[model samples]
Target: MGGLATAMLGCPGMPELPEVETIRRSLLSRLEGRRLVAVAASGSPLRQPIQEAAWQACVGARLEDLTRRGKYLIGHLGRHAAVFHLGMSGRLLVQPASSPAPAHTHLTLGFSDGLELRLVDPRRFGVAVVMPAEEVSLYPPLARLGVDPLEGDVEAALASLAGTRAPIRNALLDQSVVAGLGNIYANEALARAGIRPTTPAGRLSPARRARLARATRDTLADALAAGGTTLADGGFVDGDGNGGYFAVALRVYGREGQPCQECGAAIRRAVMAGRSAFYCPRCQR
Candidate 1:
């Protein structure tokens, strides 16, 4: 693979905490208090099918709340709910009413203010499900997600990590184990903690694990602060329509073939559990 392709492949595709957090913040800014005049869905076969009549029945509602549960974005439109999962390449775009809908735009919500919200998913892995707002928790996808990494107890994250014999990187990617982490942040967090990616989750000393936990939280917070990373594919954006932090402050994620900023060691790349992990062997472990 070429340099850029290799770098891009190392990260996970889904919306991590930072990306989802940015989306939540953006929706809060642009979508809150907006009346949903209409709702529509396209793309021949959705990853999760939405029945047409059932979808329309939920339209014409007002947005009551916007929330992030793990990697999912839930929009509460009074009496009904609009749930979105930015699986891999899905983008929630806000556009002026006169603009032509983008090619991959699968869903659109026309607002009363002459603006439109579009859900564009080139890969079609993302899904949109509409249901009664009061019972959104009963939906299978939202129900299956674990605790939000940013909001959940730190001790709980440590306890969960302690139970897994899998490598710490894999443990973080498992949604049932800890929600909202993808490969990019996992590598960044491990690098920040100076922990080897292959280290067993259960084998770390309490102090080291604590450092890892803190690094995880801090890395995510920083990413959110800078907005989510923006790739060449135009996947993520911040609240004010800017590039993500990953592109700005990434240390080890896409820096392979370059010297480690901290210890001058060459950044190494390896596949673990079918995902590429970038780390500095000399600096880590």
Candidate 2:
């Protein structure tokens, strides 16, 4: 079982972009074309202040599109939309109108088809609020974020990569350097790039930087293609309540002490910026 490179990572907490994007794709079917019959804000406010009245703005509007930026979900209605950040432990599940709402459910969006979408987060880090559709672009968090990593400016990312002395893994995790990456993905991408997780970002050769950029895209694409990774404790899942299977395809994330896929060297583990980093010491750097 430990011989594989893509073993499931045991760390579970805040989800990265791939997980959030998977939700957006799955939710599009359940949300688009469905009119919001009602919106009820229950329980405490999530990460962002949950405006009970602002949610009312979505009532009667049709959920036309579901888009994702980094780790945020944008539910579009023609003139307005709702912004959702799943923070840690946030589960946006679709259930029948007759289905009992789960505990910690803070926001509920009832649709015209007798279905309901609920935002349930035990840690209460998720956010859901309806606002002017165009307002998503002006929102501070989304606006201030860096490159999209998947389809964003590559030259800009390379420039940032060339300018930072921070640990390569840490720099990748910076939303301001490259958006949508978390600790686990950072380690995965670095492993894919064949760059040591602790290598200084600015010290990478031109070839290494290029590989890092391509590795980031390729690794993320691989994860998305497989539906995203779901770790232990199940912090991430598709909108339909199913966990992603990408975790088993991981290259080096959370494989400490296991044999490397490219080399027989045992995978090493380290703590960077208080987050776990897994890499094949012989394969990387």
Best by lDDT: 2
- Location of the lowest summed lDDT over 10 successive residues in candidate 2: 1-10
Best by TM-score: 2
Q: What is candidate 1's lDDT per residue for 1-285, written digit by digit as tens?
A: 333453357544456889888888887788788888777778454577656666677667877788988888888887888788887677888888798988888888888788788888877777788888778888877788776779876546667666568888888787876678888888899999999988998888888878988898899999888887776655566434566757658889867788999989899988887678889989899
- For 1-285, candidate 2 gives per-residue lDDT tens digits of 321212233236567888999899888877789898888877487876688777777778888889888888988876887888987679899989898999998998899989999888887767787778778799888888888888896445766666578898888878877889987788888888888989988888887888888888888899899888887656687778988888899888777898998888999988776667899978888
Model 1 TM-score, 2 decimals: 0.91
lDDT score, candidate 1:
0.79
Q: How much is the lDDT of residue 265 in candidate 2?
A: 93
Candidate 2 ranges with C-alpha deviation above 4 Å: 1-11
| Each prediction's TM-score versus the true structure | 0.91, 0.93
